[model samples]
Target: MITINNEPTAYTPIFLGTTQHSLRLSLEILIMVGMKLNDEIIETYNVSVSAIELGQLPDIGSEIAIDEITGSELSGFKAKLKQSDAKIQNTASTELEKLVDLKNVGRYQLLKGQKNMTQELNVPTLTNDNLILMRQMLGVTQKELSVTMGINEKTIRRIENKEQGISERFVNKLLAVYPELAQIIEVQFDWVSLTFPDLTSKQVIDDVLRLQDNLFLERPTSQNFYTREMAFAGEKNIYIQDFAPFKNPETQAIEQKFGTTLYLTGKGTRLFEKALLEQSMNWRNFFEKARQYRGHLTRLDIAINDKWGLLNMNDLVKAVQEKRFWSKSKSYAVHGN
Candidate 1:
């Protein structure tokens, strides 16, 4: 089960830390501490200027006495702020850590949401309840999933009703059709040491279903959405399809990592399939993008083009940072079954 809390009292950190304390010790603090400090100073300056207009001496505070901050001090704040990634990450990480059973991508979302975490994945441990939930989420009936898996609807029903444990064969089939489900249904990180939250009531279910409409089919894009298509000759049908498959290695890696992180589950794959339809993947442009994403998909120890495998945290971050980064589809569906 997922949980979230209310907003924080203030955006600023209540307690001082080693680096912040060090920064405070610098002459920069004489004028302002950070954004919060700058905001306070600016507000006071505005109010003081108003008093001056009426011929009154503004006794703002003691900081104005000895420091008598100049505009130059404020200018230096930008440079310091530029180097604040560590502090920003530390604060966000601290809050996100409260939620367990999250991969980096899930953690990133929780941070993005709370300053919050969210999503589950595909794994053997999934309950039969999760099976029904996911089937319904994709807008597919038990018959669809059954047919897609080369099985019968009765088996799907039995699994959903908790008549059996989710077998490895079933898990493999589900992931093959929806690879991204793995991360969303299971905790794949070391920091995720806590067990699942206990069921609050009989009405409350344990599995996360079509979480946030992952199962909901998307509305087809505008009529003119597909501006390009090529005709193909089949046995009896003339097939014209939009968007070519993106087979470039680097781009695929980047898309896999970025999509895995952003969409947080199968919903991500559905979105990418959309980009393939509307977003331009013009060969020359896509080739360059593939190169850029490849650079970030590897590390000093591993050359990307020479190695193709699962990415780690640093590589995932770089892939998501790509300017041309794509997203999940607003509306999508499963059809192969």
Candidate 2:
């Protein structure tokens, strides 16, 4: 039961299925069908436990940053996931709790088709940790259990270590010591769901292009003469004004296609790479997208240039001193202005 707006709502009826079955004969039939369905659910469908958990995961909110989330932000994030987890756990717990009531109804409807309680025997398959947990729950030390079972403490430890799978006699001895363990130890697989930030292709492209545009627009330039580097690319030391821009064959030919090259110094490249790496996303996914976006942005920014500044030395200075995209490709060449 849960309270809603100051009203208490009961949750009992939902747990007990609509029609309670009776008779060992009817149960055997139902079990057969249930087993068939379980196989189809697992083998025919690709659905996995992890995927189911992920589907039920609560929204973590975009306010959670890539850098840090502390105090209330962290608390609220965890509370949402835990609330969902509790809902899942309750459904499983309620189903198990209804087992005895269903069994009673079945026996009554069948007119004592199965009468009287019989001892239930199960395999002794408890793990190392589960043995310790049962001992802890009984509030007994290993030494005490050892004496009660008439076994050495070292033997108990070895069995818990999985050196022994436990004999029929050993399980009987354990039940005598802590009988509740028969009902307490249930094996359930726990699934963990992970959440990642939402990032779009447009956002990634914009960020990469913005970095290039800043460098392009503010690049240090040579006014009247070619910088020592630009001349190597194929700049003739002719008068800057004597040629009316396109009068130079090389200038006209190059302008018709692509703009003059923009040289990205090692420094600017380093700064951009660092920022791209720090983005809050999977590193492999980020770099894969970054590499593609960087290529597109490079073409757009450098494909066109002002005639006067066709040869841009480029803005890529980190203060008065000083980078990897180029080094990774190693495509640097000494070219003309």
Candidate 3:
């Protein structure tokens, strides 16, 4: 008798020795175990069968009740038995963790609903449940994800429903395509600075003002030369600076090193949104005009906030120590003890 939920089931499970022969399984039973049998041989099996009925089975060999075996005893039994190289698991979390090296890729951490952190950081795997939640958080539909990921909508639904499993390669591919999905909680572009080489300060100011709907220009102030601060909603401000005098080392002449520069912070993007709408321009249009004016992107900072402690800062420090990252800057400063 098989005991489930402390209740005995009439049917007993039988173990078979195939001896290199192909062993067939009942799809109905496999579905009941929340797993599928592939071509390879299987040694040990542990599953919950509450969802299905075991009607009939072939009498192959002696029956061993899982409840009768200890985990160490099972390990010994499994060691003596012939098993496939591929590891198989029925649960989504177990299967996903088996496929990927989570140590290499950062673990994903998330909270339940909008409350406390109920999940542990160690066993953080990108399960189908996480995928569904992430899509929902991103306010995207299954069809939209399918279109973006180039995966079949039905396939995504199947994975989410636990009818199918996704491979590690596919998981990495998905993350590569939609890097923002890894943010899991919140992602924001905090700082943006652009330099226009060809355009004068006046031209840059005029173009910026065209997009300014709620922004207020402050009184011009002098910081070496003339500078202005544009205050927007939420107390965010944009700093505009004209070229400053610099002695060219090669020419030994006083020249303007920096062109007209505009600094837009994360908060300032809020006001910039209104400016874009007022000017009937999207980000692409604005960038296009900047390119037309020979604008150069000087700096951009992406702020990823992990409220649930998903990212390990120690791993980043170790990566920097190992020189695993690449940067355009020659030197970087690491903060924290």
lDDT leader: 3
TM-scores for all candidates: the values are 0.22, 0.20, 0.37
Better of 2 and 3 by TM-score: 3
Which structure is stronger by lDDT: 1 or 3?
A: 3
lDDT of 2 by residue, 1-337 (tens): 3222244433111100111122111211111000012111111101112111222211111111111111232332111112433333312233223332322311110111122235232323445766776677668887999998888898888877878666657767776665444333221111111111232212322443232211111212354232212210011110111111223475545221112222222222222222332343332343356456432223211111111121235432321122423334534443443
User: Which regions in candidate 2 have their CA more than 4 angstroms from the true location?
Assistant: 1-124, 185-337
Q: Report the C-alpha displacement of residue 158, candidate 1, in angstroms.
A: 1.1
Counted clashes in each candidate structure:
17, 8, 1
Predict model 2's lDDT versus the native.
0.29
Best-first order by lDDT: 3, 2, 1
Q: What lDDT does candidate 3 reach at residue 81?
A: 14
lDDT tens per residue, model 1, 170-281: 7777777765454331212111101112211110111211121211222222222332222111100111112223456856542211110011122222222222222333
Using TM-score as the yardstick, the better of models 1 and 2 is: 1
TM-score of 3: 0.37
